[model samples]
Target: MPLFVSMTAGGPPDQVTRRAAHPVARKGINDSPSKVIPTNNFYGNLMLGNQNQGVWTHPYSLRWVKGTGNSSSWGFGVSHIERSQFAYGPGNPNKYFIAPLGITSIILSAQELSNSTALTTDSLEAFSVNANLAVSAQSGPLVTFPLVQGMGFFTGVYLGATALIQTDVFFRTLSGPWTLGTSLKYKVLLEDGRTWLFYVHSSQGYVNPQFILRSNTTIQGPSGFRGSIQVAKLPEGQSNAESWYDWAAGVYPVTGATFGTFNNGSASYTLSWQKGGDTGKTLIMWALPHHIQSFNGGVGAAATDVQLYTTTKGQATLVASDQWVMVEKLVTDMGFTPWTPQNRSVTTLPEKAIVAINSVASSELNQDFAPQTNLDSMYFSGKGLAKFAAILIAVNDLARNPGLAAAGLSKLKTAFNNFVQNTQKSPLVYDQIFKGVISTAGYSDPGADFGNTYYNDHHFHYGYFVYTAAVIAHLDPSWLNQGTNLQWVQTLVQDFASPVADERFPFSRAFDWFHGHSWAKGLFESADGKDQESTSEDAFASYALKLWGRVIGDAALEARGDLMLAIQARTFQNYFLMDSSNKIQPASFIENKVTGILFENKVDHATYFSADIECIQGIHMIPIMPPSTLIRSKAFVTEEWNKYFSNGRVDSIPGGWRGILYANLAIINPKASYDFFAQPNFDPSWLDGGASRTWYLAYAAALGGCT
Candidate 1:
């Protein structure tokens, strides 16, 4: 189907479309490596089982066809071609043609053994005929084929045939119960043929797909053979949508035995059938491209399409839940429909999910608060501000008891005033970096420690400040321009994200557009070069800017933050979060490690803290993000939890990390995360002293996805 019937005058503007390249033809028939186009610029190399994995459109197709004989004879072919179809996009009109289809076909016939009769086979000539379009002409990977001579062959004693078509298409690989729609036609021309069966396979975006049998043809000796369309799970996997997520999803068709789960890679599929013994029967198969499974989740309430509030001011009267009302407004304005409780598990989280999150935010609303002991460290101090912000946010939640609002505001004011006054009084220098190092027992200088070893965490430290300021400003809009004291908070945004160059600060200092992410490297000198070790903090920085931009009415800055997020999301998935095992980390670190510090040339799965499983898991955990942002995918969450914290392991872990673990769980398994935090012992000690347990609980409650 044509995506666009006609383009506007200048054609669809070359905005950010899914990134892909013209298909590359195969160099040879058999030995050549599979050539694949990336699914998206951000999440490239999905590792879908097929050689070429992506979404392909009209006038181009990549194909793989092969034949195997039971008696030491086999043939294969691979090709790329331009289809005769109407295809056009943007300034590039009708430029969908690729030349000299990179195609090769080969056949080999070995000397027959004593028991096997001498096979009269012209393997080379057979492959040549097979490669010609006349025998098996195809427009693209998706098409319905009519059985023809040599389209699939079972010639020469004990021969069989197979053909696979790979397309530039994608399926919902994240947490799937995907459905594939197709009109398949096939036939088995075997009167005295040996046992033969057809196979179908697909990849789950991270790993190769399993080659599964689609036919019921068993090797237990062929009966009176009659072929018909069939829908079978094929063994370890399922063909029916309802049973897709089952643990026993994958099975071996040959032995009717179960293996591991199916690799749901959506890149490619192959169909094959074979005959052995004196049977000279040929198996023919055909398929037409149909709908593939997409990620599914529950729906949320209807949303309005406009800004939350005409002005960011006058929100002081509105508590946190009231603020979420506006958040829902902003979210809808940003072009996202609110998610219903039923479909909240997809990557796109709805406002209802946020509201449903369970947390102790209400409990901390009235509690008196204090700063962390290590105020000298920006990380600790900034978190102190975050605690105030969380409390203020909690006290204002519509679901919470609002009697403490007046008192909460007063506490917020006092804390902000004290925080600004103390910071100005301190002798800490704020130059290219925020340096306030002082010698301590564990380390000579805890303040300067960020600049030294954990050099890439500036975003993490500063993001807390930015988040806190945005919260206060949201609650009290006048805070931005009314007082000289509040000016410091506004200046922080300028210092960090001003597009223009300022001698006092660099432009968007930490972010790197080339990498589509921010670099965490600072004063630390190392041969490995700069890298953003903490993926969550990198996202946190953008999240802060987005919130702050909304508060200060900087549209450009806010858009920049959104774009940064878009790019960061893709980059994080492709690099920081491991999908299929690769050389970036050892097998032990695969799936278990979120990239700790990814240098240009080196990748380490180590964080600044201890390298325990909890720390590894916590490296990418961001407990707080506005309800609008979908920070991580459930696929990633499932892997992280299963690999590190599954079983009774979450119990032995102590301190704030326990809370952090629950927060991480909120992404996919929010109810479980909520249950963990809801425990009576889930107290302030479980929280990083820098954050308010009350707010943390509320944040989790909002994301817990259950009321």
Candidate 2:
């Protein structure tokens, strides 16, 4: 019955094009110093001016201070925030949480590197940043630091340079030049009473490279040193932790990358780090809570007690291994289900239900297809298209109204063609600077449409259009060969979820494989690092990718979507959607039921737009699609509803938020949700612009609400 069944056989679609230029003018972005690597990544701070913003490597935050902060010299500063250091908002169960910054424990620098020195970064991959410290702007770099996320040690690869280690905390006592293999290890006791381990290794051979104590605040390395210097913070009383660090000292991860594969209902991804020294030696790495929970048998034994609290992701355990294999069971069964909790290819609804759904669909089809004003925002325009597409799907599939479906599909094509033709008020432009398709609206006003021009929330904004295109193409497969229709949608997907690093777009721009989630923030400097607000929209983007992949027969894309969705479901349950039994978040904060806005340095139980309980909780529940039930599990939904919106509390919140909460409630109590929406006096204003009454009714009825 499918039009392009052969395309769905294997691999990605052969005709999917990767365009380097758009019809609109190219915004000149020639400021990038390193042209080889992608600009927008986890290590983007290294490319920005002065490069002072901290890049979060979980359990630790590293910054290229350039001699401005507490270290009082040009170097990289390392900071770790403890549980006691978290600043909380008012109330018994705090409303928000943030970790403090500028608390540097150690500063790794060189005698040749100072205020007069210059810095440039290259080889910017997904997880590593190579910072080259030079004597001046014209001279070559004397030392390079391969800064990587989750690395147990801060290593500096010297090319005939002198090392200068300094700290604001001041040195209290220094112990040992103990020889472990080819590394000379030293234990430093700081004024803050923390034990710091330092290791030095040489390329020529095993030789003691002495570090002369310059003062209470500075330690100078041997002149013209050509090897590596590694430093790490150890637990106060854990002697065993020191041995683990020493065992993995000589080797360091120069670059880190990830590869994911999915088969049947099981999916796994391997996070690998390429070692720069002593290739045979095992590397010491820190694993976040999510990593520790899903790690396979490939990793070595973990130092459980020797842990550090990440700014937002809870405790990060130390793993004495290089590669981590994380496996997740994908939701392979979910697809275009009409309105059921269980996935189905076909269903026969009751006559009365069909009649009601047809009437609602007809009414929705007659409304305006696209917004007449403010046509610039891809986010709003895409929402309009998706809303009508859902109505069309309901009419044809659920209501079995062929005439109405045909009428709606015609209007949907006209509306979608506006974007394909690039005739919208704010047309898209290829930002040569960031190498992504972005709106021109942000060019005139940087904050317009939630910073779309500046590369923020691309996944959330473009996902709706991608889903709508998939729906239209599913109903009319002939549309795939139409003018720029498929290419336009594929461009959006490549912008946000490109599987490979190409010449135009970066690989996986929005989705972060490391965090098990997508970051909404982009191209902006934040002290807390990247943050994502709506977990539902994040999941919805993945859902859209899955559907788009299915329609175009890109098996890899579909598999990635399934893997991402499965990983998100696992992580959201662990971190964001907290039940009573969760031990990952703080004991007091878990009572909030949901984390509203999670930043790299804080977990704020409030939305940026409003602090109202409905907005904060409902933000995670909008556009309750099929995958909604997967991510927002019945247990989590029940717990969240009972805590925040139970006992008639939801009735008082009079807005679209009320509808979202009820729709989400269908996961647990479908009868109650259906009854509320089916009320004779149901107000249309309660529904969001992106939602339709017909789909909600069908959704509820299919989930056993019509009984």
List CA RMSD, all candidates: 22.0, 4.1
Cand. 1 TM to true fold? 0.48
- Report the C-alpha displacement of residue 685, candidate 1, in angstroms: 2.3
What's model 2's TM-score? 0.93
Candidate 2's C-alpha runs over 4 A off are 1-40, 204-206, 300-306, 338-348, 372-374
Which candidate has the highest TM-score of all? 2
Among all candidates shown, the one with the greatest lDDT: 2
lDDT digits (tens) for residues 625-649 of candidate 2 = 8778788877778888888899999
Query: Which residue pairs clash in candidate 2?
Result: none
Residue 111, candidate 1: Cα error in Å is: 64
- lDDT at 101, model 2: 75
Q: Write the per-residue lDDT of candidate 1 for residues 359-462, one digit (tens) a residue.
A: 34445544655444225566666777676676666555533434455566666666665544443223222322221111121134423536422223556666
Instruction: Give the Cα error of residue 210 in candidate 1, in Å.
Output: 57
lDDT of each: 0.38, 0.77
